[model samples]
Target: MRAALAATGRVVRAETFRLLRKRRMYVLAALWWVVLPVLVLLLARVLQVTLTGSFVEGEAVSVKTLLQGLASPFGVARVGLVAPAYLSPSPYVIAVALLAAAGLGEPRTHRMWKSTLVAEPDRRAVLAGTFLTMQAFLGVLLAGAFVFGAAFGAIGTTFLPTAAEGAWGRLAGLYLLQWAHLATLLAFASLAIFVLRNVTLGVVTTFFLPPLVEGLYAVWRATAGFEPLNRFNALFQGLELQATLEAVPRWFLSNNLYLPARTSAAPLLDEVVGTLQAVGEEAGGGPGGAQIASLLGADLTLPHAGLVMAVYGAIFVTLLVVAFLRREVA
Candidate 1:
């Protein structure tokens, strides 16, 4: 047992050092962990200033506050429509593509595993080392996000924004979503390496093919009403930073932020009301029936979309583990 643990420790340490030596990892981490969040915050602030003629202040600015403020604008500052354009999923997709390529495809590209196996000769040990290193990297990424978010949120407080429990809830949800998103990227990247055994092509296709597939698939599903592919779309949706924005309630208009409404009611109540209205309209009811029935309905909240991403993650990790076990390090 002691000897096994020692080997595992060495495997982990070696993998960590190997990944750290890669300059690309440093560049990617800096861009994703530091630069992107700052850019997003600045853009949000700019939109606020341009529209309202002054920034929308938050009582205590949170990441959610900044995003929500930008999502819906007030009178004369109605360029809020441009908000979604800036809030694109492209950054994350690109980052994840790079990570997937590095994490799964690197071993194959460099033929590192063959040499490692000669020393440890234990396939499980190699797999464990690789995944533990990935976990450590992910932990750092998440912690950095939390710190960046807190700082960004503090800076936002100068703008005097509204606060809600849901905002914080969404913040927590976003963190979890990051894990699910990365895991899915790693899974596909790992699969690509398993099949092709080449880092460049596997990495390229892992990143490149998805957007095209998503676009075409989206169109096909929309026209053909394909059901299975719709759930696959959930995988794409869950990875996006803006996915949480879509899931959250855009309750009030931009200018009405200061005027408090009857929100003392539970968030579930509102979610229920909204869902019923949506379903009722789809069912061919008039606006009056929709309005009348909406009040009577309850919010049918399920596990967050983040949970769906986690489920995909579980499937992904399992497949990668299986691939690592079955394949010879040729």
Candidate 2:
């Protein structure tokens, strides 16, 4: 078992490094993590300014107040670091999903699996590594980009972020929930890759099929007695199966979680959304920047949402492994 675990770890590390070796992945990572987040931040701050300016008729607005409100860069702990991305089937997920599914589409084209099997000889370990590597790659790309963007966004808004220990715990939980979400995506992407058996088709199906089905489901739900997929309705979806957040947790946007956490204990994290709507209401972040503050929250107060992802992750991962083991190599 120890040997198997080691082999899995090695495979995961190797697969992760293998993906990193691709130059385009970096470009895409930068586009989603750096460029997109910063762009979102700037636009958010601008919008805040525009709205605040338009609403205020005549009052001596303090510089301090302006500064306090200026750190509007989204998904940066002000609005639950995952909020902006959770708001839609973000390019971050799409790009990652496409890259993962596309490359692994058939695997026969790459023909690395036979060598991989010879080296590792454990199919389960191989599959586990592949799945984990996908998530790890996503996490590294996301966290790396987030660190830069958060630091840049932190300017002027903070005197010095001193996030509480509780805040760090909540943040860690939120990230765990986020990983569950990514796992669900990878499971589906895995299914798409193997089933479609073509890179282009896998990409198209993985990215596009969900939204198409969602539209039909929406109309059906609207028209009559549709209810099985009611969960999908509440969470907005577009382009495909990519889900949009219905209600994000309000974390109270303590700036410390955004900056100081990085310089200190790396494992501790902060919230992006509320663990539960009730919890969000209770935490009372007048500023509101919650994510999963507890295991109870896990991306949403809705057990249906969390449960769906969890169930889907399990089912799909199992299916993919069984399917992969059976797959014919050309």
Error of model 1, residue 189, in angstroms:
1.7
For model 2, residues 1-330, the per-residue Cα lDDT tens digits are 998899899988887777777777788767655665466556545645565545342365543244333342223433334443443565544755665663465355577777877888887888888878777776766565555545555642343222111243555455545555666767777788777777677767766676565455445433542234555543444333332221211111111111222222222233323234456578774223432332112322324455556666788778888887887655
Top-scoring candidate (TM-score): 2
TM-score of each: 0.59, 0.65
Model 1 per-residue lDDT tens digits across residues 220-324 = 533542235565555755676334422222211110111111121235356666676677789897333333322222221223323444565577678777877
Q: Indicate the TM-score of model 2.
A: 0.65
Q: Which parts of model 2 have CA positions greater than 4 angstroms off?
A: 44-80, 83-89, 156-172, 226-302
The clash tally of candidate 1 reads 11
Evaluate model 1: give its TM-score: 0.59
